[model samples]
Target: MADIKPYTIAIDEERLNDLKTRLSLAKFPDELDEAGWDMGSPLADVKRFVKYWQESYDWRKAEAELNSVPHFVTDIQCDGFEPLAIHFIHVRSKVKGAIPLLFMHGWPGHFQEVLKVLKPLTEDGDGVNYPAFDIVAPSLPNFGFSEGPKKRGFASEQYAETMNKLMLKLGYKEYVTQGGDWGCHISRALAHLYPQYCKATHLNFNSANPPSYFTNPILALQHAILPYTSREQRGVGRSKWFDEQGRGYNSEQCTKPQTLGYALADSPVALLAWIYEKLHDWTDSYPWTEEEVCTWISIYWFSTAGPAASVRIYYETTQNVDGRKNKLDHQGLRAWSPGVKLGFSHFPMDIQVQPSTWVRTLGNVVFEKEHESGGHFATWERPDDIITDVREMFGKGGGAFGVVKDATGYAS
Candidate 1:
């Protein structure tokens, strides 16, 4: 039997009532007099969301809107973990020679991040000079509509395995990828583990250490002689700020997720504040409407694995099982994969934006661009920018042109 089947977003009425009931009975804590965002989510902002979530927010309308996209689910069996019903959106370009592109989303973000780029990436390229793509954006195992793995230790390698297998099952022998946040790490893991199939990768976030004298003599020389650009300096400050004060969520999620998961799973308010804080802090000054904010949280609130399962990835990826951390699991995830071509775009507001040279340390650098403005959620906030970079990288005479050989990424 074919494991892949079409999916529709239909939440049960009882779950909807449960969410409203919980939101109604939520007990909120007091905030300091002038505490803005310096303290986590402001009491007022959350209270507003709670009111909207309970009274004004219509999940059925949101579900109908999401159903407009093409979604499918299939069983992906990882080595250690059981077979999971993975959810994905596969939009095939009409162009016969279109390239297959797998887009991945990270924490606090779901496959919906790929929604904005879908029409442009798959439709707008017709008769245009740029190449078109057969897009596959999957909600990773345990996130969105995908079923979660019940076993422990399903880290990046397992994620890579599931994604790679998903593409292969769809008959894509080779493909390219684009992402930020955990998408960056998971795509990097794919390039590392399955370099044979992942021909090239384009990333908005670059998480890598500086070149070393012993291992990267030439890059180290450049690092020693050249001063960081003004933008790089600011980026360093942003990263430092994150390391110091902004990354409390990471610690809790990575070390003791279950303890935190109880609150996330049980309380609608806890889940709202937990994800809402990231949406606010991770983006540039992009004005977020109430609908946008609630739509995002509601997905998690009604995810297949429940809201709690998503955070376990932090623990699985970080905690060393038996003190044996796989290359795709830890710091080694950002390491270079020899056969894959690379493209990098630097946006100022991303939490860990690195210098162009530093990003080059990660792989065979082919394409690079610096956007005037953008942030971690580049796919949504800067959709055109992300799509332009991909077209430039794989377009005619572009650096990665014909990397997948017959897949020209263009219509004849």
Candidate 2:
């Protein structure tokens, strides 16, 4: 608590002016006639966003609303990386023993995803019906308002360490976590590295490998014996589509983020188009209002570490430039990590839509549910679903019920 400080999101007026100037000079690339999303963010769409961003969108309103949440900053120093001033939202429940829950966001997502579920989760509840939670949602290093590490090799382990330390600093000796995308990976790292503290986890994204006989005997048997359900088959198709068609951004971010950083840093429109493509492609057709789109882009445009620094997470985590074992490497993190209880929510349109059996191999899966809609941004696209799954996972009779010792997440 000594190192923690209250914080607010105040983008400087000069930075706002600079963004407007950049938007004014934004250059547009040509698109073929009727080129609907196949090529990229439609030129017409980008043009519309630019016009809205300059003329109609209001950052001050967004900023004021964002500041209404309880924001805080603290310096979390991971081993071998410089100390980073991590920005987070922490809201406590009035329940006597509310469970501490860490909500993590991945690339292209900021701390905003937590707002939808934050209040609902922290509301006081009877132990038998609903479980309350103390939510801690952090902007990962190099993303949102969190400071970027100056050194390289700040991979998943470092991110997990930063998060774990943040929780411990805030006096949460044991906690649960929920996340998607890179959030899924970091939660795995925490479970593996600090199982005693990271009591349980719930994931919306499936970045799992096929079940192997040695690692997951029961799941492997099920995988080999059972025929693919229609849902599983459709999920495989979605996964294939993502690998083949939608992974160009992943390849570039993993291999050469610095090369792309210039465009993201120099031109606000370039940053918008780059991320807006994913916003359009990744979700389950959730209609994004103009204000919503502008605010999401503005978070990147006016981020404390600058937008370019955010992409480095992809490169640092994927490439073994130093040839270390890298326990937190993306592939390694996907492997089984026992001890912590697990819950999963499967959304059809997510990037890596593995079968339920595949993800079960990752840990002691206690609960799971499948939904027909939603995409990569499950927390945002389907917050109600996320909230329901979490409540059911930790509520009375749930598989992970009372896992966090005294924290039953209810009023006395």
Candidate 3:
């Protein structure tokens, strides 16, 4: 492990200006009379966001806010393969007895989502109470300031292993993990691979299962009727929908991320639209009233990480698509793979998928919760609720294996 160094946020005005020029000159595809997001990201929506980003978004302000928090960069070698450096922010709680919590964000999301909660979490009564935690939010390898993985083996499973090594390198023998989107998978993978190091794992989505002797009837039914049901089956249904409508980006990334790399890597607005559209759609909230979403876009814009970071997912997951000799299984991700156990706090409004019994059959679910509010971006949309749930689930002295029974009599 190399010594951690303090990090700062600095923006390149010239690059941003160039990005604005490109957005101004972008040749948009013509929309059919009935055309809309059903085919892909709505052009009107992207245009509105781009207009706001160019006109009103303040990158320096967002940068200043980010700079207020302490950040560090360090390298950790996984099993002595080679050292991989990572960038992370550490918001130490002033409150006594704060537990260390590691928050992970997924694709189309950077550390910005978690940063929204830092101030409230660290302060009490207008001052530092530093309640309950020293939060560490790192840009996963190949995302943000963290260097992209050197080799082709940096899958989510490998990411889990790297994160465990990172925690150990930081001297956190045991710590709580919280994630949403892809972070959920990586966190669960961490738990699956290093249960001893991960004290507890919490997720916005639960998608994997342990090997099972018998098929779960309920899950089987859900899987069988998913296409006809009003409720969307996460991962699968979403992937299908995306493949039909929203997957152009994924297809491009998976097949030719390098080709689009120049545009995303160089153009800030392109990067913003590439990432922002997902943030808009994934959350329960959409058509983010300009001010609401631009703050997030500004972070990427100023940091100039829009394109480079966006491609990390492509770099990471492309192999899974290309290397498979057989047709890719679109219905579900491979279960029984070594990774974290997903815990879902199913929200009523969003498309929710229960953890298949297949998952429970293989591994133990140490903690689970069902909250009444919030969607994909839990931390940003409902920080207090998310923080409360996190504290309750991972609180010190909270043992693993606590049974969580939902009102429906579901033991999740």
RMSD of each: 2.4, 2.2, 7.1
Over 4 Å off in model 3, which ranges? 79-82, 120-131, 209-248, 301-306, 318-342, 348-352, 355-362, 396-412
What is candidate 1's lDDT per residue for 113-135, written digit by digit as tens?
99899988887665236788999
**Clash numbers, per candidate:** 1, 0, 10
Model 1: lDDT equals 0.87
lDDT of 3 by residue, 87-198 (tens): 8887766665455567898776778778767766545421122235557788887666676555664565567777887676666766667787777767666655676667
Q: What is the C-alpha lDDT of each candidate?
A: 0.87, 0.88, 0.60
Q: After superposition, how far is residue 400 of candidate 1 from its true place, in Å?
A: 1.4
Determine which window of 10 residues in candidate 2 has minimal summed lDDT: 403-412
Residue-by-residue lDDT tens digits, candidate 2, 289-323: 89999999999988889999999988988877356
| Top lDDT prediction, candidate number | 2
TM-score of each: 0.96, 0.97, 0.77
Worst 10 residues of 1 by lDDT: 403-412
TM-score-best of 1 and 3: 1
TM-score of model number 3: 0.77
